[model samples]
Target: MGADHAERVAHRVSGARLVAVSDADAARAGDLAARFPGVRAVTDPLALVADDDVDAVVVASPGAAHEEQVLACLEAGKHVLCEKPLTMDGESSLRVVRAERAAGRPLVQLGFMRRFDPEYARLKAVLDSGRLGRMLLLHNTHRNKSVPDTFRSEMIVRDSLVHEVDVARFLFGEEITEVTVYSPAPTSAAAEGVVDPQVSVFRMQGGAVVTNEVFVTNQVGYEVRCEAVCERGSAMAGRPWADLYTTVAADDGEGLWGGGVPADFLGRFARAYDLELQAWADASRRGEVVGPTTWDGYAATVVCEAGMRSLTTGEPASVTLVDPGPAS
Candidate 1:
């Protein structure tokens, strides 16, 4: 994701230019810098953040490093686009939120790129139009072909389902108050000790409901789908309308359905990622944040922490979060 964001900023985004990038792997940073002329390579993330030539920051470091780097950027008075799990836990996320609040403006845009996706944008518009009446329930599913070997069962909530957590908050226009996670039987294809698929339910403060099923080893392909059940009507997102299924049937009329699914995250969210970077860069240039704010990132971390606790305790876990202040 760090590399992807760099590519977008260096080339795709209009007002953005990659001034410098850092990686724990110095060689990797050098390679990326080589790809983009005039972009410098910094061995340490802090050095990147402190670079005088850099106008803004993009926090894509690993989860543990996010808190320090993001806070440092805020302290440096640079706009940032921090990737998900602003920190591994809610406390650290709150620190970032507090820093943003103290700054008296939104300078951090949480990388909930789904919010920028065309389908998701349309869905949000539909919900906002009051045509949906009041949203009662939302059903979301995130499926992937597989995860890396290091992936564990807990990632079903903390990683995969976390996206839906943010989406619910974004679409419902409320905070998630509670979370409950239920694990079904693991499939044969699941990695050892890992629950390949899990369900997470969220209760919103506005009395809305959200359920997310995370399947990281569907052994099929990458796909994300969401549907909302509202008082007046329903809206769905992420379905590919350009699907073309070839028929292989015998004279007896027996047939098989076949089509392609997204091979990876980039395939599914290429446009969203691009648009998100463009929006982030444009907003940063204007000294404003027009995307998901730091508060949204903190809310997601709080919800994900509760979901992880519930995933193990097998009980509904309450979410506790600090208000990022109305003026923030």
Candidate 2:
């Protein structure tokens, strides 16, 4: 993810330049830095944050390192674009939120790139324009071709399902009140004792319900789809592959017709990621932050924590978020 973001900033995004690269692996950082002219490689991330030439920072490091790096950026008065999870858990995420609040400005933007996807943006527009009346239900599907054996059941909730958690909030503008997760029998493709597919139901504060199917070992490529059902009508958005079917001649005199799916999320949402970074760069230039805020990150973490509990207990769990207080 860090390398991908580096490529975007150096080649695709405007108003930003790749000034430096850092990683625990010094050689890896050096190799990436060598690709961009005048870019330096730093071994320590905190040193990267304290660099004088770096006006703003992008935190694509491991989630465990996010709180310290983000807090360092805030203290240095630099804008930041941090990738998802915000931190490894909800408590650290809230601490980062408090640090941002103490800074007295919105300096951090969470990388919920789906919000910038063209189809999703159009769907959001349709829902908000009153054309759909009041949205009452959302159906989300998240699938992947495969994952490493190291990826566990809880990771499905934390890594894959977390995206849907934010989508529900982003589209409905309401907090999720509760979440219930149901894990069925594992598929042969899944690691032993791992949950390959998970079904999660979310109840929103506004009486709306969301259902999500998360299948990490679907063996059918990366596919994400969302449909919003409303009082008057419904709207759906999905991968462009959904519209690009092809026909092929076969020896049996029958034709095979189907569309191709992306091998990963990068292929599925490349444009969205570019636009997200561009928007972040543009906003940082103005000393402002845009897109998903720190609060969105914290909320998703809180909801995912509840989902993990449900995964264990096989029962619905109520979502809880600590009030950021009147100052927020």
Candidate 3:
């Protein structure tokens, strides 16, 4: 994902060069660097930060490693763009927020690419225009073909549907106060002893109800859809990759048609990825916080954690927000 971001940023912004690339796998880093000529490959991220030549950093490592990498970059006095689920939990997210505040600048941007997507932006504009007449309900669906065996248990909430959590917060323009988790039946595709599909219901502070269903056995394709039903009207968005084709038989039949689903998430979100990186690069260069802020990331983490707890205890979990660090 970091490599993809770099390529998109390079394409969108002129005079922007990738100076260094790093990965735990030295061979992968070297290969990425080779793809972008004149870029240096390094095994250590610290080396990239220590170098005086590099201007900023993009943290696309796994979720568990994000807090440390983001804080490290901030301490090194470099701007950073870290991928979603900024940290494993709210506590670590707060630490990153504090580190940014202590740095005396907005150094970290969370990679919530939906904020930059055209459809989502359009939805936000419509909602902000007051045409929605007080958003009453929000429904989001995030389904995937399958997750790795190790990721079966909690990844649905943390990694997959977390995007919906963030988007729900953004769309409603309010915080979630409580969440309830419902586990349907386990599917054959899910690993043994894991919940394959889960539904999360949230009550927003402003009396809006939100529900998200994360299903893991969509062998057909990857799907993402959202609908905001308001008193005035309804706005809906989704990704439907149905292809139509027509073929006539030997002067005997009218026509034959077919369609297929998009293979995976990367294909569906390719444009969003490009837009996300371009906005981040532009914002970083202009010294502005353009994409999702660390605070937003922290808030999403809080909601996800609450949902997870609700799943475990078979109860509705509540979310509490502490004071954001001193004004930046």
Candidate 4:
């Protein structure tokens, strides 16, 4: 993700310059920096944040490193675009939110790129238009072909399902008040002791309901889909509406016709990432922050933390958010 963001800022996003790249591995950073003209490699992340030439930053580091690095960016008064979770837990995410509040301006934009995806944007527009009446439910499906051995059951909730949590909030225009996670039998491709598929039900403050099916070991393809069910109508994204309609002779009358899915999220959301980075860059150049804010990130983290607890206790958990006071 770090490499992907660097490439976007350097070659794609306008009004932004990839002045420096940082990694714990100096050689890796140097190699990546060598790909772009005048881009320097900074071995230490803190030094990268403190670099005199860096006016803004993109934090694609591991979630655990987010709090410190984001705090460093706030301390330096640089606008930052931090990837999902904001931090590993709600407490840490709240701290980052407080820091941003203390800065007296919005400087942190979260990397919830799906919000920038054209399909989702249109869906949001439809919901807001009142043509759908009132959105009552949202159904989301997040499936990956596979994952690393290190990816665990908890990560299924924290990382993959977290996207749907934000989607619910974005579409419903309310906080997720509760979460109930259900884990069925693990798929054959699942790692030992890891749940491959997790079903979560999110209750919104507006009395709307959202359901998410997160299956990381689907062994099919990377598919991210969402459907909004409103009082009068419905809309969906990532429905694989193919250009051709045909029935292959190999399948006889089985009626198997659908577009191919991407191998991973990077392929599916490439354009979204580009748009998101472009918007962030455009906003940062004006000394303003846009897109998903730190509070949104923190709220998602709080919901995910509750979902994790539900995974353990096999019960629904209530989402509790600490209000950041006025001026949030």
Q: What TM-score goes with each of the models?
A: 0.94, 0.97, 0.92, 0.96
Quality of model 3 by C-alpha lDDT = 0.81
25-48: candidate 4 lDDT, tens digit per residue? 889999999999999999899999
Global lDDT for candidate 2? 0.93
Candidate 1: clashing pairs of residues: none
Off by over 4 Å in 2: 239-241, 326-328
| lDDT score of residue 190 within candidate 4 | 92
lDDT of 2 at 233: 90
Cα error, candidate 4, residue 129 (Å): 0.2
Query: How high a TM-score does candidate 4 get?
Result: 0.96
Rank list by lDDT: 2, 4, 1, 3
Between candidates 2 and 4, name the one with more favorable TM-score.
2
Ranking by TM-score: 2, 4, 1, 3
lDDT tens string, model 3, 107-203? Answer: 7888888777777888888988997788899989888877778876577788877898888888887888998888888887888988878888999
How many pairs collide in each candidate, listed in order?
Answer: 0, 0, 0, 0
For 104-221, candidate 2 gives per-residue lDDT tens digits of: 8889999999999999999999999998799999999999999999999999999899999999999999899999999888899999999779999999999999999999999989
Residue lDDT tens for model 1, 1-328 = 8998888887788976788989999999999889988888999888778888888998888889989999888888998888887899888888888888887777898889999999999999999999879999999989999888688987778777889998998898889999999889988888888877898889999988898888888888998989999998899998644454455676788886666788888999999999998888888889989878877888888888898889889999999887656554
Pairs of residues clashing in candidate 2: none
Which regions of candidate 3 deviate over 4 angstroms?
Answer: 10-15, 239-258
What lDDT score belongs to each candidate, Candidate 1 first?
0.87, 0.93, 0.81, 0.91
